[model samples]
Target: MIEIKRLKFSYGETPILNIDELLIPYGEDCLFLGNSGSGKTTLLHILAGLIKPMEGEVILAEENITNLKTHEMDDFRGRNIGLIFQKHHLVHALSVIENLLLAQYLGGLPKDLNRIYQALDDVNVLHRKKAKVYELSQGEAQRVSIARAMLNKPKIILADEPTSSLDDENCERVIELLQYQAEKYDATMVITTHDQRIKKRFENSITLR
Candidate 1:
């Protein structure tokens, strides 16, 4: 769960995000709708503890971690949050399984081979476990990223326009995997997107004007 109040942020005196108040509870999937420059990414970064807000508090899992040191924030974010980006940020040289294993190791999570394999299996990429990251198609690589995000079994999942590039079928696959993992982990999911395809799946959506 996440709670924010009077959160304000700026880039060199120019305000980019000014969230009045927001609350997301467990077992919830939310769609955040915003146009270009509507501060969607800014807000998501704040939630992910990637930026320090000029004002307000970020409370996650009962920790009012408004002032955690950068290293602490990084560790917390790694273990607690899973992020899915539109472009799969995979290392081209590593094999599919290696990329996922690296993330788990970076987060200092337990390196359970079965868990890793199960994650890949969930994304329907278990067979590609030995394939190099660059060998995957866009859709396959996206699944690899999804696998990496869920590799640590994070309690919160944040995705940025995950379905924007794919066809409808692939889009469905993308969304379905996210929702399924959210349920599997009982994680709160907050997705930022301009795409309308995910609107129906979210019970509630926040629109930025």
Candidate 2:
């Protein structure tokens, strides 16, 4: 459940996004396709309430996030949105489980060890939960990222360029994992990317020129 209207955003004098209206229903998986400089990431940030649009209304989960205060936006995002960045921003010094715990703490949620372990297990990373992030392979680290994102059972999951740098096998695996987790938690999944390999996989897509 996401809706945007009269969305316009700019960086200084240059316009970045100019979406008139968009809607995504609950439990749907949508792909945002665009080339470099096409503002795919900018649109994702706006949807996640990480940036404010110059003029627009971003209604997520029946609330207009564009009007929320800073702290209120942060709290709402923490509780309702799960973000997966392309870089997989895990703390290298912390163990996999520790990184997950930090996310829970930052989200103002109680630390549920059983939930954390179940998340890891869902991503097939429970075996590496005690290992430091730096010790994981690229795939393992990405799995851990997925686990962390789903730890809170968010209502929406946003992934940015998730399959950009992976081999075909890993790319497929990542998409499957994202869809699996989304279905498991009944969350809407939105993935933004320029990767053509994934274009045919999603029936619902928005292309930015």
Number of the top candidate by lDDT?
A: 2
lDDT of 1 by residue, 170-200 (tens): 9988999899999999999989988888788
Q: Model 2, 1-209: lDDT tens per residue?
A: 88889999999999999989888888888999999999999999999999999998999989999999999999999888999988889998799999999989988899899999999999899999899988999999998999999999998899999999889999999999999988888888889999999988899998988
Give the least accurate 10-residue stretch of model 1, judged by summed lDDT. 58-67
Task: After the best TM-score superposition of candidate 1, give how far the Cα of residue 169 lies from its true spot, in angstroms.
Answer: 1.4
The runs of at least 3 residues in candidate 1 whose Cα sits more than 4 Å from the true structure, single-residue gaps closed, are none
Q: Each model's TM-score, in the order given?
A: 0.96, 0.98
